[model samples]
Target: MYAIVEIAGQQFKVAKDQRVFVNRLASEEGQEVSFDNVLLIGDGDNVTLGAPAIDGAQVSAKVLKHLKGDKVIVFKKKRRKGYRVKNGHRQSLTEIVIEGITASGAKKAAPKKETKKADAPKAKKATGKADDLKKIEGAGPKAAEAMVNAGLDTFAKVADAKPEELSKILSEASSRLAHIVTETWPKQAKLAAEGKWDELKELQDRLDGGIEK
Candidate 1:
């Protein structure tokens, strides 16, 4: 069987035991990482597709190692303006081998629903642990995932994160996240960490979505 799955920010067609290189991920070497963004799965002539991503479908792989891709030169010039710039960049990448693919009805979060009655405790636990980054303005699912994967999963950590550092992380993850401005994220994260909900709300409103103007 083979499946098209998204890893980091790019998608690839992967099959069992196949080794693939992708943008660097935060998973440790030898650790198993699973992707739920299965676009389609195929086994022989039978094919299953998803509107965006298949529900309950997961692809798990073990990270083999991390390395750098071949360096490429970037050249830019402004004619008549006498402006010329040249640089070289090497992409960070990770090598992973597909372990298995679980098609339909193999939800990973299925066990978490058994204790539905413990929602109250879970809420408190969540509030004290790795906070939901989505609460911070300017952070959506993809952006938040990038942050969490980089180990800045808590409000306090995010509050202390420098804008330049955060920018580098986002840049390395995907060019799509390049447009996301994080100038005010630390300040907003600080308020959230301190439980200053009112102040955070005020700042987000004043900043007009908590993005740099």
Candidate 2:
């Protein structure tokens, strides 16, 4: 059976024989780790979603290997200050294969995951015309695409966005989008500098409610 499980504070849908990389643990290779935090369980014809988590449910996995990820080089410098620092780090990881899922809900054998051929590269989808988004003060074409997906297609919409509202809308965003909004967006930076996004959002919400500004 397939199950949704949490590992190292991250949620993942896992099925039997599927290999997954998770945070480093002290288990030896070929050892077994059974997580009792199954969130959901699914069979061939039935699916069960947990209320936060399922009781008496577990997902067992076998540790295949312990390895380090690719090395990352960190460099820091102060321009014209004659100060520089360099460091390298590799994240420890554990690769585990899902073995079985057990619960009172249902039972189903896991299906083999489809593997993509190495020779066939995935195609990239075009976002939109770059010029359409480049005109915004702080948004580029990629950022505009992200905004559009988040239901903000106009500059006025961005200007009226509340920080918490924006955060909720972009909760599924990649780290790149988070970094762009937190570190790169000029108007957002200005609003953050003035600490006015919350107030702005409140005003926008009131306006939408037909309250006079």
Taking all chains together, the TM-score of candidate 2 against the true structure is 0.45
User: Model 2, range 1-213, lDDT digits (tens) per residue?
Assistant: 789987744678999889899755445688977776678888988888888778778888898986778879889999999999986656566799998888854333365345532332321222442124334333456556665666555445555666445433333343233312211233543443466758545543433111122
Report, for every candidate in turn, its global Cα lDDT versus the true structure: 0.79, 0.59
Worst 10 residues of 2 by lDDT: 175-184
- State how far residue 171 of model 1 sits from its true place (Å): 13
lDDT of 2 at 48: 84
Judged by TM-score, which candidate is best? 1
Q: With candidate 1 superimposed using the best TM-score fit, by how many Å does residue 163's alpha carbon deviate from the native?
A: 12
Candidate 1: residue 27 Cα off by (Å):
0.9
